[model samples]
Target: MDQAIQGKIEEALKGLFTAVSMLQDAYPGKPFTPDGRLVGDIGEVVASLAYELTLNEGLTKHHDAVTDDGRNVQIKTTFGTSLTFPVHHVPDYYLGIRMNRDGSFEEIYNGPGHLIQAQLSGRKATKTGLHGGLMAMLKRINQQVPDSERIPKR
Candidate 1:
């Protein structure tokens, strides 16, 4: 990475850490681990910005985003791991995103909910057990999407 770009990324991460720390301080009882829910939220935010999708912050059935074309998108993100099956609700499409340790996107999978569910149905829920199969499916799906549909890496 360029020195300037690296510096910018470091600055952004500091800001995110400060924000999360403030939230933790405000709500003492909540579980806000950096590696858990925080990363997931960051992933969602990144996806929303990348795809220009509208996020549903309130309680919703299944989908997290609504596209301009009226598609309901459910985004599931993991850190180089497989997403668990039997999500609370099913959406029109399932978007599986894998993030790097630094919270940058590594890969993305977009496909029908049923197809993704079927592919992951019989797998063990643990990260170690599900990673291989999930990655394979994600790679296949990733290839299907046009470059226009994907977010450009900065």
Candidate 2:
């Protein structure tokens, strides 16, 4: 990873968490977690920088960015465990990561979308993808992907 870009991410995450901590401290019982679109957006930004991808204009549905070689990629990030893949909308590539509170992250999955699609298919369709299925299979699935197939980090 680029130290400069990682530093920027750490700075931004620190500030955001500091604010969330203050809010949580105010309400002693409730927890204030940074999730949803914020995490998704952060993942997209980090993935774009790390993989040197070109982010698509607006919300382009299934894919978020185009790789250097022009393959469409769907980026996924989670502060917690598991990601909900849209079964109906698989892209050319899929990148999944987990973000920690300290602004660090782990690449959970990165490979062809078919890998994920196979894991999520033949299940009940709902507004959300991968309900009870495929949650525990990411690491196992990611392992099958050869490193050469992944986009090289910048």
**Evaluated with lDDT, which candidate comes out highest?**
2
Cα deviation at 67, candidate 1, in Å, is 0.9
For candidate 1, the 10 contiguous residues with the lowest summed lDDT are 124-133
Residue range 12-108, candidate 1, lDDT tens digits: 7677667778889999898454565666676677677666467788646667787766678777787545654343334576677876545456655
Q: Top TM-score: which candidate number?
A: 2
C-alpha TM-score for every candidate: 0.60, 0.87
> Cα deviation of 107 in candidate 1 (Å)?
2.8
User: At residue 152, what lDDT does model 2 achieve?
Assistant: 68
**Relative to the true structure, how large is the alpha-carbon lDDT of every model?**
0.63, 0.81
Candidate 2: residue 145 Cα off by (Å): 0.6
Residue pairs with backbone overlap in model 1: none
TM-score for candidate 2 = 0.87
